[model samples]
Target: MNICRPYLAKLCSTLSGGPVVSGCRWVSNGPRFPFHSVKDIKNWDLDSDHQILPPPSTIFAPSKGRRTRHDNFLDFKRIRVTAGGGGDGSIAFSHSAVQPFGPPCGGNGGRGGNVYIMACKDITSLNGILNNYTAANGTMGSSNNMHGANGEDMVIRVPVGTLVRQVQAPIYASSTAAELGDDEGGVEAVGQDETENADEDEIDVEEQNEIYAEQMMRLLEKHFKFKTNYRPREDRARWLMERLPPKPYVPPPVLLDLTVHGEKHLIARGGRGGQGNPHFVTHEIKGPAICERGEKKEPVWLEFELKSIADAGLVGLPNAGKSTLLAAISNAHPKIAPYPFTTLNPYIGTIDYSDFWTMTLADIPGLVEGAHLNYGLGHQFLKHVERTKVLVYVVDLAGKEPWRDFEILQAELEAYKTGLTARPTLVVANKADLPRARSNMEEFQTKVQYPIVPISAKERRNITHLTGALRSIVEKAGAQG
Candidate 1:
């Protein structure tokens, strides 16, 4: 406990408190102790009220009577993308000073720039800058057998929660929805009789409409004729709904922008350069230099949108050991210390249940009093939790009253969004290493009538038990579904 005081102090110093500042001195000499730059922590303000932090639409909500920005402002909405094309090879001849007899020389083209979306645990907020993004291909080669410089590649940065989808590939009920438009247009034109006595024009219009309709019908037959459907009407509707474009991943019932983060989609990309004529002027042949061809252009449209952040979200009051548990259970390496509200964003970790079943867990930022009303850091981090299927509430058993902690958290969740309480939940008690934790754990069990497991994440105690229990619960839900 003496050794831990300094670490605890450092955590408090990072937070907005006096006690934590005093505790940090002991940790200064410890090997595992961390000293973070104040700059890194500037983005986070523990004292800020998040729940009432301006209702995602109010432009500014008062924090201690001062106006503040919307909670979702930190959430990114835009991400631009660009790809590089191959560089053109230069065509030149090597002429000796004496003989001056060299075959045509053409360098090979530089390979096209490859693009990738690397998975990261932190660094979300892609949706914030998705707008105004662009990518370009590599340049063509020069004349003196020098290959043209390759175009610079543009990588589309996105949060870990983002999934890439092609631009608006609408799957129709069937390709041939009965050739409704062409025939209907002709019928309407003929019926209107706007062109009086113009029978020839009407006949031409009729023939043209029939041809257009036939072409459309043929295209549909060619593309969708082989498709098969096995689902019910409701399932079909659901599938369509799934395919339907999302209405921008906004905080539910918030005033985030519809124009910038809305239905916009990428339409086209820059074309690749044509080949230079150096391969045709071969020595064996008459002209190997002229035989080479330029690369073909690849113009494609791409669309990306933010999806739900994670499947399971870990939430609760401050100092609940959310970060410790996250680091212990998965590869995620969130900062952990004996303090509240250590995490700012929703940290993600992948929990592999089996070869076939793997689910992601989100360590949502800690909640405090009046979080939903934007009372603290809770409001800023609450949106990330909205998409989770399961909510795990971590309670500090040793620090304070466990049942009161639970009640406070319940109130915070309800205040933020009413539906959050309805999600599947598990109440967990942390810090079992402390002597006083057991009695508090038992009391919580009796009062809540739900199974409560006590654990010490820092000590690595009961970690396996906690993980096994979580797996059982998650898998059971899957089975029932």
Candidate 2:
């Protein structure tokens, strides 16, 4: 007579292919168990009247350790946009005492919203566009030939080197109870087969039932515990639920690059408004009641990728003191650390050689051995180097292998993109104050063929000389271009 006893009995009966309990209906194809498959348990929505209850749990819970703020130097982003639909046209007539049947005075509908992507110098990252963008719809036309208000246009601002590409939106497939019901029928069939060989399959049927029951309970308990611990809100919960196993695959297409600042590209065009009844009042027909509806807005997806632009680029392996040299010669304040890969993003600084002449220098994150293969923040860091006309290879003299490090840096650059080694290059031997650095510098000078500048970045030794050499090289490169 216990409420739980009835549910358990029903479950055993369904699994054993036995007759259902009197006055009991199947909630689904199988027994009405609180915990089923991981997918099923999360989506389970029991009726309020059902007495036999499931353990308190939620199907959706937010993922742990999700970043709340946008990354300041994010180079890539995928955004979805929904342009507003055009407003409907009105078919109202003028109601005045002067002329009873005056001219047909229906108004035309307003145009829909448009989406534009613009490149700007002030913005450095795609972090500002974290949320999906949407535009407002136009207002409906009014009486007396009054046109509807046009929808507002949305302008998206990206970095100067950003490339915008149009891509198709991702489609998510939903799983239904009917799909899971197949498993129930299979279990029932197995149970019926076991009954035919009662004695031989008795233990097998019991074991199978126990295994399924344990699996169902374990999945329910795991998710239920997570839901209780995280206690995520609706939005976060939904985000987590969507990311559950079997993620969707969406491949974006390649599109044109937007490199110049103040450049504008139309990503989505607004829908056209429909004409009012007055437009249909032609010579052949009088007072036509026909009116067209506004066109529907089309949604679009865009991919934004940023590539930093600079006249000069500083490249080196991790912990090679690139940031220190950048701070010494330019006004940029990149994070200086003794650790590897400390600088996660690129920093741009301008050096003023004269009142009218100034050059921009970009300090990118350090590269590693397999940088070309996307190892150690390689792709993002190396991408910024592509825009630089001159390259300065910063090497740590104190590390005892400046030559090998320089070779590796050059190899990575060449591997990622050709013609980088052919560009005007300078070798800067940093950390010259160290005891062994002076000895290493002597060896580096004898082996390297390019111009070598030895200076202790920490002590600011010979920094002026290094900057002068860089300015001269930049000028020569500019003149050649």
Worst 10 residues of 2 by lDDT: 219-228
Clashes of each: 53, 0
RMSD of 1: 20.4
Task: Report residue 465 deviation for candidate 1 (angstroms).
Answer: 1.8
Q: Which regions of candidate 2 are displaced past 4 Å?
A: 1-71, 173-254
Could you give candidate 2's per-residue lDDT for residues 1-481 as a string of tens digits?
A: 3336565554445443456555553334643333355444334344665332334453224456533232365889988776777776666667779977767677777988887788888887777775588877877777799999999998988888887777656653113323444332333455556556666544776676755444443332322223124343444334433433231223344375777889987676677676676765657546544344666654567788788888889999888998898899889878777788778888888888765688989888889999999998789789899888999999999886889999999999999998888999988999989999977887888788999999998899999899889989999999999
If candidate 2 were superposed on the true structure by all CA atoms, what would the RMSD be?
Answer: 22.5
Candidate 1 per-residue lDDT over residues 1-481, each given as its tens digit: 3325443444554433233333244323322323445443333333353211112223233355432232233453323343455555454566789747576665545545544444344445553444444445556555556665555444444455554543422235123343343332332355445445456544677665555444444432221111133222333323323322222222121111111212222223333343444554434444233212233233233444443466678888877899998888787878676666667666778876555567778888888888887777556677677777777888888866888888888788878888777777777788888899877776678777555777888888887787777777776766764
Which candidate gets the maximum lDDT versus the true structure? 2
